[model samples]
Target: MNAEAAIDLLKQVVLFALYVTSPFIVLMLLIGLLTSLAQSVTSIQEQTLTFGPKILGLALLLIVLAPWLLRALTEFASSCITRMAIVAG
Candidate 1:
């Protein structure tokens, strides 16, 4: 592939990565914010307190989103593979 095509593929890869990861990232951020707020309000400053909730939240989100995530990932992978074949041949 030419440099332009390669760059476009790279851009797509980056965007896909961001799109797939956004939900998990946003969930973690929200959980962290809530945990911080609660800790501040109650004066309970435990560093490890956030880990449990974050892990649990992520686990729950992963479970709920697994099918959709898998389908999206599979589609992206298939498209990428097809593009690779086209570029190669």
Candidate 2:
């Protein structure tokens, strides 16, 4: 593929990655921030305080969103494969 096409595909790949991971990422950030705030308020500055809640949030998020995430990734992959065939042929 030409440079422009390659760049376009790269952009798409990055955007797709960000879209797919946004929920988990946002959840983790939110949980961490809240944990920090709570720790600050309570003066309990334990380094490990954020991990448990973030992990639990991630697990719950994955459990809830796994199906949709998988579907989106499958569709994107299928689309890329079909486009690849078209470009090749």
Candidate 3:
């Protein structure tokens, strides 16, 4: 493929990755902020406290978003495959 086509594919891949990861990432950020706030209020400065909630929240987010993430990835993959076929043929 030409440089422009390769760059376009790379951009699509990055965007798809960001879309798939956004939920987990945002959840983690929110969880971390809440955990920090809780720690500050309770004076419980435990490292695990921060990690545990974020991990659980991310897990829950993954469970909730799995179907949508799979659909998005599948669509991206299908589009890539179709484009590849067109380019090759």
Q: Give the Cα error of residue 81 in candidate 1, in Å.
A: 0.6
Higher-lDDT candidate of 1 and 2: 1
The whole-model C-alpha lDDT of candidate 2 against the native structure comes to 0.86
lDDT of 2 by residue, 1-89 (tens): 55665666778889999998888888988999999999999999999989999989899989999899889999999988876654554
lDDT of 3 by residue, 1-89 (tens): 46666677778889888978887788888888888999999999989888878777778878888898889888999999876754554
The best-first sequence of candidates by lDDT reads 1, 2, 3
Give the TM-score (vs. native) of candidate 2.
Answer: 0.90
The TM-score values for the models, in the order shown, are 0.95, 0.90, 0.87
What C-alpha lDDT values do all the predictions have?
A: 0.93, 0.86, 0.81
**With candidate 2 superimposed using the best TM-score fit, by how many Å does residue 33's alpha carbon deviate from the native?**
0.8
1-89: candidate 1 lDDT, tens digit per residue: 56666777789999999999999999999999999999999999999999999999999999999999999999999988877765665
Q: Where is the poorest 10-residue window by lDDT in model 2?
A: 80-89
Q: Which ten contiguous residues of candidate 1 have the minimum total lDDT? A: 1-10
Strongest candidate by TM-score: 1
Q: Output candidate 1 Cα RMSD.
A: 1.0
Indicate the residue-level lDDT of 7 in model 3: 70
